[model samples]
Target: MNTQPSALANSAGPVSGDSAAAKSRVLQIDRSCRLPLMFLIACSLVWLVAGGFLSLISSIKLHAPGFLSQSSWLTYGRVYPAAMNALWYGFAFQGAMAVALWLMCRLGRAELMGGKGILLGAFFWNVAVKLGVLGILAGASTGHSMLEMPGYVSPLLFVSYCLMGVWALVTFHFRQERQLYVSQWYLVGALFCFPWIFTAAQLLLVFHPVRGTLQAVVSGWYGHALITLWAVPIGLAVLFYFIPKLFGRQLHSRHLAAFGFWTLAAFGGWGGMHAGAPVPRWISSVSIAGGMMMILPLIAVALNWHLTARGAKGPENNQVFRFVQFGAIAFFAASLLDIGGSFRVIGEVTDLTVFTTGVKALYLYGFFGMTIAGAIYYLAPKITGCDWPSDQLAKLHYLGSVVGILVLVLGLVAGGILQGVRINNPEIPFVEAIRSTIPFLGLSTLGGLLLLAANLAFLVNVIRLLALCCCTNCFASNRSPAGSGPAAAGANL
Candidate 1:
């Protein structure tokens, strides 16, 4: 320090060798974990396209009720539930399982255990989702928002999830790494919480439907926890992995992560129960207070990631970076909407309007969708042993998703506010309020199509990548490459 000039050295702090070591480790991990990642991407694209189409139909019906009213099978109620089933079970659940498998392997530093079992679980899960969606289309839905699939489907889903959870847990158990990573904490909690929450919610809602306003309250509670238990954990797991990996550093605030995780566990499920209804004043007030309190953990998470990435020039090389960046931003926005929607005063006007739909879209598409998209991007190159077919294609996918979701959310919000104003105004006819939403609904349909197009392109890219993997030249080129293993070839999904 005495010999060195102040202008020539970093004054903030010394860059530890550990930071460099962490960066190298992340690069190595990314390089090794490829094949399973690609399969996850393929599944996500397929479900997004299916979900987008359903959303398209639902949005159109809002403006023109007669568009698909002729067929009982295609009615809005059936179509909307079926669409959600596709997105939730088909897209989100399946995709998260794949990502969870990969992340556990990388973070736990272990190879996947029971490859055949994992594939079998995935197969059964898909079969369950397929039958469940068909049931919804046939008017056999449980008539609840998140638990729409008929009671029969729950057993199949339960079996499938249990099997897959076993694979992930066992993989974590066998990892060579001595210290448990923060990502593993969330991952373990998620895998454990899913079966418990899902079984209980299904039992209560399907087997013993609660009466009156309590039913709505319980339904909202289940819906909120469904996302919290399934999507939020995965999103947090991804954040824990990518931020540290991309920035070539350990989480700057591991203590902060633990606090945030526990806080979410304590508070997340209760806030959504305030979705509608004039519950006891104190009850509604507590729920709103809980929603507002979520701001702390949310901010903690954002800071944890941001601090890790503080001085990094850019993220690591891959498609994963593109998808994850969008997801991180969406997570912040989704949390803000949650807090906003929690207020009873706000809900009084927006409760039945399109704003509720917009809130749903923000959580599903904006938050969970983006994370899944990023996982796919990160996994494809690792599995295929070839760079993404085109970086431009990756950019297009993320851009399309962001633009599409924003447009759809904005259109719905604007329309919802307009509808609320009209409904509240005694001077305006109800038809006039309903009619005003046409333009906004029109905008939503356009956004849905845009999202659909993006998903199609993503699907095509994945298919092409898989084709290349099967190619004689590509297979030969990858045969003896670094980090390739039976797990890569055995992905089988």
Candidate 2:
């Protein structure tokens, strides 16, 4: 059963019935979001492309070693962190913000307020990110893992965030709907979670540097907490909202969802501390325990969603479901890998190898990226007042993302395992261990190429759709009858 009504989009049908009134509200919400969401999503896609390009450059350097040796700005040291931060701040955070705001307005029955301010905040955030990435290329990075952006710009990022964050809370505060949904729970949590994680990370790592092993401890905590707090919650928010609604089913269980949410809140940040970390032994032990304990929430969520979407098949025709399904599955796999890898036995083997790359790819690209893609696919038509202009490109992006991430994760994991094995063996020379990983690195490079191509297609599709809307709006404005103004023309967006 297709849950989405497809005959016409944003068509002003007879406003005679309850359904019409309901749709009018939906369109109103979409319209309120049109410009801001479109701008944020466009920025995200551009950053996504930049992140992919830098990542590919870094991956190639793993094997080729001299792909861009002539350029100081493109050195692996700079490019790798630059790539990660681009995805982190530039693509993922902005995209998540866009999705979070849209979800709030739609699910909570809230009108978006402070639209222009939100847009300004987004613009400044991008400026800060641009300067930060450039600073990294210029050797001004703070040298912290997640807080690599220079200290000078951190205030701007935080201030810019507050501009948006305060408004997000305000929107939710004034929502018409009295009952809060599960998706809103995750979204609200993420809205608060990011600031806590970022501020603490920046204060300790950047403004006033922590000393010795504690800095590493703090860095490790920040990196892991980011995935758990910011990324995972937002990704789950999207999944929980979309899966049942798109599949035409009610959620499986409220109790289970509450279970998942609370358990994740309690345990999520505690994981990602490794056994060998120089922190107190008990800290590592607690972290390891917390990580294993996270499986409880993971199982809870998997059950809630799986049971809800049980009868529905993966629909090729529905790009939203396809991407959402891919993301949900990846979330499970990635979470499991993250939990399982925390065991001392596994951690000892995979530490400092390409296996970490596989895990990051699985979590970031496979889980969160795909979820955002699905949300964009679902929201673009409503917000733009038009469906995608090209199906072929959408399908191409889907195939490429699914195949590319899978290949990259598997190749890196297998390669990393072998690489780790060689590193752990005293008889094996470090040089030999490095050489053993080259073949797998080559495979990951190929995967990166495919991923890059897919994103290019996605970018083109977005641009083409937006162009069509713009042209339609412009054309309509020129030929409109008397009293039919911008709002009337906007209906054709």
Candidate of highest TM-score: 2
TM of each candidate vs. truth? 0.87, 0.93
lDDT (Cα, tens digit) per residue for candidate 2, span 8-75 = 11011111125766667767766677777788899999999999999999999989987889989989
Q: Any residue pairs clashing in model 1, and if so which?
A: 34-382, 34-383, 35-383
Once fitted onto the true fold, the runs of candidate 2 whose alpha carbons sit more than 4 angstroms away are: 1-18, 314-316, 478-493
Pairs clashing within candidate 2: 384-493
lDDT of 1 by residue, 1-493 (tens): 3344321111111121246664454444444444444554566568778877887898788778999799999999989889888988888887788888787876665556656566667778878888999999999998777889889999999998887789788878876564666778888988888887787778778887666666566677677777765588888887677766665565777689888888888777665566445655666676678778788779888998888778785554656776777788888887887777777788677768888787778778887888877776766666455666666666677778878988988898888878887898889999988898889988888888778787777777778777776673345665554445535424522
- What lDDT score goes with residue 27 in model 1? 47
Report lDDT (CA) for all predictions. 0.74, 0.84
Total clashes in model 1, counting residue pairs 3 or more apart in sequence or in different chains? 3
Off by over 4 Å in 1: 1-40, 275-283, 316-318, 472-493
Ten consecutive residues with minimal summed lDDT in candidate 1?
7-16
